[model samples]
Target: MKRSDGLKMKLVDTYTMERVVAGSASRYPKRIALRTYAEEGSELTYSELKRKSDAVSLYFLEQGFVKGDRIALIGESCPNWMLAYFGLTGIGLTAVPVLPEFSPKEILHILQDGGVKAVVVNARHVEKILPFIRKKPEFLIRLEDLFHIPMPISGELKDRNQFLNAPGRDITRRKVDAKARQLLSEHRPKEEDPASLIYTSGTTGMSKAVMLTHRNLVWNADISSDVYFKVKPGYKALSILPVSHVYEFTIGQVLALLCGCEIVYLGRPPAPSSLLPALKEVRPHIIMTVPLLIEKIYRSSVLPTLKANPKLQRYLRFGITRRFIFRIIGRKLIVTMGGRVRFFGIGGAPLDREVEAFLAEAKFPYALGYGLTETSPLISGGKPKNHTVGVIGKIVEHLEVRLEEKDPATGIGEIAVKGPSVMQGYWNNPALNEEAFTPDGFFKTGDLGFIDKKGRLAIKGRTKTMILGSGGENIYPELIEAVINNQDFVTESLVIPEGGALVALIKLDIEAFAEKMALSVNEAKSEAARYLNKLREEVNKELNVFSRLSKVHLQEDAFERTPTQKIKRFLYLRKKDESSDA
Candidate 1:
């Protein structure tokens, strides 16, 4: 299949990670490959990166590690982490990237499941995995130590006599280099070989290790670069998403490397305070983020300001006036976002419609993407210029996507996909493998949506989250929650069914509400009942009849969420049921 750009999708049957690193180094040796945002942050050129990775590979080989050996990499995103990944995978070993945010138990489960033989970890993560040390894998090396140790320049000249015998030194050096290259080539993994064992973030259920082969990752990177990204060599990308997540691993790291782009990894979590300075310093050309971060910026920075200004709010009702006004505001937003971002890729979850509309009006370069870890994380996405609000743009090249088991009237169905990027299957879990795929081989995505007349996909909700109304109508809680979340003083919300009645669990912005009302916390709490009643009535006005909330409950704490900041709906649903019975 050829992409819309006329580039044919050719799956390489024998492509390997070793070739990828070597090709990049050969093509752009002097190019800045990666920059980190740590206190003593540094940048690495392609040549340096290739050399360090080779050194690490040689070290592993010296330790008797060979093909198919599993190595665990657990740490925050850093240059050493990438080197370790490249080194291990270049020598045909499986790299298991454990999320740094995982609890000790979660980490142990993954290490055990993969039978990880060695681990490369940051100092911060050592204590967490100490319990597993006794059940020893071959080695446990610290990432910082690897970064400080330099690779040998001349393969360790033994004594002064060997040093003085310099007539044949140049030939010896060439021979040593050739031998190292040969060793790497001998162990190079095939396209079908498992390159990574990535565990899902488990927003819906327990985490499962997803086995992605070299072909699955490389092909996805090729297609993404050709179709969705169009990133040029020397382009700069700010990477804030966790590297362990397949979304970031492939698009943020692999695709960046493939295009010879310089990636800047934020040392700290991308909280606004830290992120603002990093953005200014890096001035990245592109950014890959989840909806939660952008939505928070919209709610905290954009929404409140607009709501406070009546004239601006009224102007927003008209297209021309809104665009003109937002243009000025958007310029400021661009400056705040490093002043050079050509593309802001939003994924992980569906973006809020209000936020998307604002970005469109402001002419912000933000694109919506849709996919899951099972599909190497990108099933569909488009450039900012082609973005349609509420639509997850066209299907990506080389993939077949369909809406299965559609309703005759609404045309909604589960989004199923078949492509090379899809995983081999859940690791060692035959039951899940059988349940995950249809008989014909499409991987069931478990999302509910319909393709519009223009062929753009719009998600209604997750199939697991859809509620049945009392009158047997389908109610998408996400749609209702979006409305509720847009209301004044609401931070976030979750809508669930209870005793045949729709209930909303809301976490209010208490501090903001109290400040707005000019009341103390005690006073705000005292009057919350009356305020919540009015808030519920206001939200109902924006929702459909079937999706209206029967009652609203104020949640004292924020809802438990996954690593991606998606609310753990299962946890809240269980709690809601328990409360209803109480």
Candidate 2:
């Protein structure tokens, strides 16, 4: 409850955080905790999780590993992801989570850069770090063993036998650094003590290690759960999203533990083929996903239905019985997501306005949020603005938000915040860390947003993505895209300033345009040029002075994306050979 700068902090009491969560087994011993991705398969429970955690704590003691020693948790999102982190935290250890998508070189960079001693990883992800074993033999430890609390009957290689047999240099050499580990065992990490170091994805620069204290992470889980999820006793979460990413990492792992929620993690991908079956079975109450997945449902399934029969769309939109049937289908979707999917959260990237509108009209409670990893990722999120539409929710309590350095006319600027959830600093990089915080201690979020008179915040774009105009004006490309995406047939749009004027690179709904033109699916797409000119005229008529696209550039391919599915605009910006005339 105490703070260094004398500012009062909203602390999630650790004892309370774990009380029900750790005792889930006794309370809901028969309830399912986690189910693998496979259909109708293995199920774990609260009691099982706690016992496994104890075994993990015992395993550390047996191995002579200490509290603060950094354990590389290399995997995406899964049941074991939660166990490794909480078991480490519960026993006073710090967890270092490595992303599954990292290339071999990048994985090596994280292991060597973090000075990690042991690793608890998915047997699948071990391959990514194999080449680095010879490079850092002393620090190597298998990530596969971190799944179960007790060693699985010894010599136990369910998925790891392949590694033992591979012809690589022996990794078990030299003494493991025991200082951090020892600190964990001797003294519990205080609220202010650093608990983990997350390396940023190097899309911007060399990945900087973010130093987050025990309080920093816990505080994020506490508030995010209360405001966004209202997480309560026996809450069930479908934990399939990659835990290496902050959004899933917190909800899929920390939030569940802090709220006594049952975490059902599938150690597999959530592609449509596998996801629907799991949903039909677990019937989880909570589901978290990015805009990409939701957008696909709209494009592939939802749109096709509306396209096949225009009357159906109109009938569903207006008729009472049809609306009831639609609600039933939505309810089934929610139930398949774990039965209580009251809150379907979409974050990490902006939601397309058309997709959001469809959900809103359909009466689906698909709430949206805005944030980056810099703020332990949860910033503002809630039900969409009905009257205004597309506004991000009000700022959560415990965090102070204000726009810093802006143009008043546009009412936009980079969002800056100060809160307990903010990280300690970037590890071992004081220069970058210093740049990250303002002179007054506010953390620079690099995101752009403006508050309405009624107090809701709407994110416009990232500060770095702002296009420098011929004059001094700042133009947000995403803002321009938002307007374009509102059009019914517009699938996705990206605004890239070319030759000092704003240009829109867009992908339209070919089938819809084809139907509008009375053409076959193939013919509709083949004659997309006619539709482009028509859509261009419509979009141009709709845009404001600063927001209007000077021209339109239609792209055949969707887009280049980061691992998290965010568009890599820099690639397009840096390419001199792009269709500049568009």
Candidate 3:
């Protein structure tokens, strides 16, 4: 198949997960394939990665694990996590990646629901799974001990190094290595065979496991590598998002390996302190992040400076001057971001219009993508050169998409898609599977949006999140929240329906507001109330009548969010009765 770059690429249908790694290993054997940032970081060449994965897979095979056996992998993003994933899926085992951020109950539910037979977990989360180990899986293996351990049977061998050096270990490793070679030479996974089961973060409700085959994931990666960005050999990518999410797994890890990019996994959270150093050290070529990360940077760094300087603010009103000023600032931002970034890909949520505008004005090479885990996550996206602010550039190559139940006035409706990259269905849930697809086989996205004349997809909101006004008008809270979030002193806001009126729960920058108003803590709270009322009047004037917020309430605490940093609307929805006054 030909990629958008005019490169002739092998179709995913012709290969399996094992072949994907083997092909890359042959091509970039000595190249640094993966790196992990810890107290002392580690690096692995493509050949070493393949060898370590083979050794891990050998242990699993020796322990009686077979093709189709489901194994759960739970940990933060790291080299071992990827190695375990490749080790499992490379041999046809179905890997279930559970987010480390999930609660213990949530983790238990996934383990039970997926019917996981064995688990590969990090030491930190081992305690959370220990209670359920006797009841759920057959055995557990620690990721840190993956290299030293001989077999993964529970209570079998306590000494890892001793076991590795033992004569029995040598026999098992030799046998497993031979079997691995034989399988690679003689057997390969079918395109239809299940590869991984990814559970959604469930921002709204209970999470469902989405089953993706080797073809579903590999095809998405191959197509994206061709069309999304230029793939330069030795390109460096700093993976900040959780690898458990399909968005990061396929694009950040798998696609990067396919394109021969060296991936550096941040051992710590992507907070400014940790991220800044990694950026300087790695000097990455690409960064795959969610909108929240970039938005925070803009809010804390750019917005404050622009707001304080009247001269710069006036210059921003003129396009020519704005570009010149922003270019200088953008260059500094790029330096702090490790200097050589060609692609700043944002997904997992909508980018704030103001933040995106700043990026466009600065000429930052930023791209936006829209998708759900069901589609293996890339429904629409494009290169920065072709990007249009506020639009998810265009439908990706080889996918068929359409709108259902379109509203005549707005042309907005549920998005439905059909493509090889789309998942088979929600695992073990026939009812959900039935509802997830149209009779014609298009997967129902449950997201509301309209395609522009130029083929750009501008999302309106989620079907489940749209608020019904008192007069029966449709209100998109996200649109109203965007306006509120852009206001001065407002950090974040959530618009919800309360007693048939739109009430906003806002988290204000109390410290900043107090300093700006020259008020004490108690006086600041009172002043904030008055400011919110006045701000409400101003915001309502900009929004449509039906979408206007009736009241703005202050939230002392931040709104609870999902692993992906999406506000858990369902949690706040039920707590409307407990609404506090501003």
Q: Give residue 55's error in model 1 in angstroms.
A: 2.2
TM-score of 1: 0.91
How many collisions per candidate?
Answer: 0, 21, 0
lDDT over C-alpha atoms for residue 575 of model 2: 62
lDDT of 1 at 31: 96
lDDT string for model 3 (1-582, tens) is: 665534345534243677667778888999988888653547888988878777666666657777888999988888878888888877678999999988888898888888898888776676667556645434666676453322333434334343333232221133345656776444346767888999897668768899999888887888788686787879999999989999999888888998888999988889888999999999999999998998998988898998999999898899999989987888888899899999999999889999988888788888888888899889999676645777888897778899999999999999999988899999989999999999999999989999999887889899899987778788899999999999998999998888788899888989889999898877888888889999999999899888888888988898888777889998888777665542
- Better TM-score candidate (1, 3): 3
RMSD of each: 6.6, 5.7, 3.7
* lDDT sort, best first: 3, 1, 2
User: TM per model?
Assistant: 0.91, 0.82, 0.93
CA shift of 409, model 2, Å: 3.2
Of the candidates numbered 2 and 3, which has the greater TM-score value?
3
Sort by TM-score, top down from the best: 3, 1, 2
Best-fitting candidate, scored by lDDT: 3
Model 1 weakest 10-residue run by lDDT: 166-175
